[model samples]
Target: MSLSLIDAENTLASPVCALAGRAALRLALTILWHPQAQRIGEQFIAAAGSGDIDVNRFAPLFGGLAGNAQALGHRRIARDALRLRRHRDHGVSLLPPQSRMRVELNGAMLAGAPVRCTPEQVDAGLVIGLGGVVLLCVHWMDRLPQASAIAAVHGVGSAAIRVRELIRQVAATDLPVLLLGEAGSGKELAAQAIHQASARCRGPMVTVNLATLSETQAVAELFGADTGALARVGGGTLFLDKIGTAPQAVQAQLLRVLKTGEYRPVGARADQAARARLIGASDHDLHDGSFNQSLLRRLEALVVRLPPLRERRCDIGVLALHFMQAWSTRTGSAPELPLAFISQLCNYDWPGNVRQLGKVVQRALSAAQAGQPLAFDALVPGVAERTARVRLGQLSGQAVLDALEANGWLIRNAALALGVSRPSMYKLIGKHPAIRQIGQIAPAEIAAALAAHGGDTGRCAAALRTPSEALRRYLRRQAAGKLL
Candidate 1:
C-alpha cells in the first residue's frame, strides 16, 4: 500500500531488482527528513553512493580543516563525522582525528562531556542529527549469529524470539542493562549475547556475582582498595550478578559508581571515573522495598524481564536437542536424544529453569555413558516420586479447608498435618477466610504443642511429610499473604 511495496511490484520480473530495490527503499526509509533536510539527505546519499551499510564499517561524508577522512572496508555506512571500525572482540570505535566524540543518548550526553573515549561501546536505538540531515544509529549487532545463539540457548518460543529481539535492539548502546528473571532462566546468557553483539565484544566482560562474594570485604578483591577495578576494565563490560545480595556497603558503592560513573575503591581516598559498561542481573524483583530504590533506578536504565521455563514449555525440546547435539560434538560420539525422552522433559514444571534442563541433560549423558538407556525413568531418577510429591503439593481449596478443620483451627497442628512449617501453617490458616481459629483452638493445647516442638512448624511439618507452601497458602486464606 505504501510507496516501497508499490515500487516492488514494478520489478517482479528480475529477482535481483526486487532485492536491490527493496534494500534501497529500506535505506531511504531509514533516512527520512523534511523539505530542507530532504535536499541535504539527497545530496548526502548521492555523494555517498547508495549508502549500503555493513556491520563492520562506517564512512564519513564531511571533514574539518585538519584532515581528510577514510572509510573502513567492512561496511559502507553513511554518516557525516564518525568513522567506526569493528574489531572481532573489542567492538567498534572512531577511526581517526583522535578528537573528542560526544553522543546524545535519547537525550543524555554519553561521551564528549570530558569522558575519555574507549574502544568498547554499545548503542540502542539512537537518533543522530548529522549536519542538516538526520540518521539513526543502528545497534552494532544486527547479524543472525546473535539471534540464532539466543534461540539455541532459550528456545524457539515466541518469548525467546522477543527476548532475542530486545537484546539486539539494545546491544549497541551505552545504556545500562538490567536483566530480571528466575534463577537458571539464562540471564547470564542474555548478558553475554548483548556483549557479543555490541561494539564492546572485543573487551573482556568481567563478571562478579555479589551473592558469591563472602562479605563486604570481598569488594576489595574485585573492586580494589584503590581506584582500579572499573578503570582496569577500560571500555569493557562489568557484569554484576545476583545484585540483591550486595552488602549495604557494597550497595552504597554501587549506587555511587552507577549514578555518576565516579567510584572510589574500598580504601581509595579519591574518586575515579568508571570506563566499564555495566550489566546487572537479579532473580529478585529489584524494586521491592528490600533493595535500595536509588540503586535500582540507576542500574535499571533498560530492564529486560525473562519468561520462566514454565511459561515457555515449547522451547524445551529445542534446547534439549541443542544441548545433546553440542555434547555429541564435544565428545565426538553420543546417543541421539529420542523424541519420547525430549517430550518427557518438556512436560516438567522446571522450577530451576534452564539450569535444571542442562543438569538433566548432563545426567542423561552420564547414564548413556554407563550403558543405561535414555528414558523418562533413567533421566529423572525419582520421576514417579517427584510427581507424587507434586500431586500432594497441589491439594485444592477444599483440601486446605478440610485440613484446617481436622486440625481444629490450630494453625500449628494443621500445618503439621499438611507437612508444612508453623509460619507456613499460619499462612494456610489465613487463606481460609471462613476457617478462623482465633478463639476455636484451646490456648493450653496450642501452648503445649509450641513448647513440645520448640515452636518449630518445620519440624512438625516434616513429621507429617507435606510441602509447606500448599498448607501455608490455604491456612493463609484466613489472611492470605507473605512473600513466597
Candidate 2:
C-alpha cells in the first residue's frame, strides 16, 4: 500500500518520500501551532507505524517536540496546529479509496479519482485510510502563517497571505488607506486590521458609513458641528465606509483635510489640525467619475484590494471552520460540518463574499440538529444546484464571448459572471471561434490597439478582446525583443 502525493505545481514525489515529508511537516506545524499539542503528540507517538505507509514511525520523534513546545506555553503555535489538524481530518474523510489526489498549495483539491469518489466528495486539507489505502492531504499545513499575527482576518490561502502581508506593510505608514472590494468582502475587516496594526492602535478607532448620512448631514456627521468624528477620532483612526457614496461637498472637505492636515468643523471660523489616520473603503469603482479624483488619489496613497470570497475558494473551508468555532463558543453547541457541505461551500460563487458566508454558517449552525452534519442545501434552497460546476457543454460560444466582453476579458470575473468555473470559462473561450487569445493576435494589431487606447492596458484589452494580463505579457516580450 502506497500513498500518492500531487502538489500544487503538479509535481509528484515518490510514495515513501512524500509520506515521510508530509508527516514531518504536519508534526512540525502541530508542535508550533496546535493548542492540544500534548494530546496530539501523544496520539502521534501512539499511531507510529499504524498505517500502511508506516510513515508515523517518525511521529514519536516530532510528537515529543510538540509536547515540549506546549509545555513552554506557546499558544499561537498550538492554535495554528489545531486548525491544520482539523483541515486535514476534513480532507481525509472526503478522499476516495485507491485514488490519487491533485491538490493546490491552499489545500484545494484540484482533481480526485471520480470512480472512487465524486468531485462532490473531495475537500480541502484531508486525510483518511481504508484497508491499506491511506490518503494524506496535509500538504498546506507547512504554509500556515503565525495564527496570532492575522487574528481576525481568517484564511489560509495564498491570497489571504498576500492580504496579511499588505496589511503589515501599510500599517507602518501614516498615509490615508483605501480599501477596495465588493460588498460583504471584508473591507471593514481590512480597515480594522490596519487600525489594529498601526501606531494608533492604542487610540480610539472610529467607523462612519458615508452612505448612511444624507447630503445635508454629511459634513456635520464627518467633521461635526464643533465636535464630530474628526475630533472624536483624535490621534486614532477614522474609517469611512462607502466613501464612494460621499457627496461632492464631503469629498471636497475630505480632500482639503488630506492635503493640508487641517479641517474646519461645521460653523467653525478656524480650521483644526487633523490627527486621525484616515481609511476609506468602497465597493464601487472610484475611477468611474462619480468620486472626486483628488480625494480618490489621496485615499489611494496606500490602497489594499480585498479579494472576493470566490477568488479565494481555497480559504472557504478554514473560514467556515472559524465561523463554526465562533458560533459554537457563543451558543455552546458544537455542530458537525459535513465534508459534502464544505465542498458545496467551496464550489459556490459567493457573490456577497465573507460576510455572506459567515451568515450562512450561522444559519446552518442554528438549524442543525444534535449529532448530525450540517445540511447546507436544506438551509439554503437550491444551494446544491447553484454550487454545482457548470459544464462548458451547457453554454453557447456566443454566451461565453458575451461574458468575456462584459467582464473586460478578465477570465476569473467572466467565469464568475457566467456562473462557471474559471477552467471551464477558459475552455469555452478556447473553443469559441470569435474569441482570440493574445498569442493569436498580431503584434501590429496589438500595437495599434495600444495606441488607440493611449497605452491603457485595460482599454487595449477591451478593444482587442483579450485578457489584459496576456496583453501585458505580449507587450513585455515585444519590449524585451523576444517578439517581433
Off by over 4 Å in 2: 1-148, 370-375, 381-484
Tens digits of lDDT, candidate 1, 104-203: 2222233331111111112211223232223323222111111243342454333565687778776868888899999999898888888888899899
Best by TM-score: 2
Query: Residue 102 deviation, candidate 2, in Å?
Result: 15
Top model number, lDDT: 2
The lDDT of each candidate is 0.52, 0.60
State the displacement of the C-alpha of residue 405, model 2, in Å, after optimal TM-score superposition: 26
TM-score of 2: 0.57
* Per-residue accuracy of model 2 over 275-389 as CA lDDT, tens digit each: 9999999998899897899888888899899989866654665677678778878878656655445545655668789998889888777666444456667666776455543
RMSD of each: 25.7, 16.8
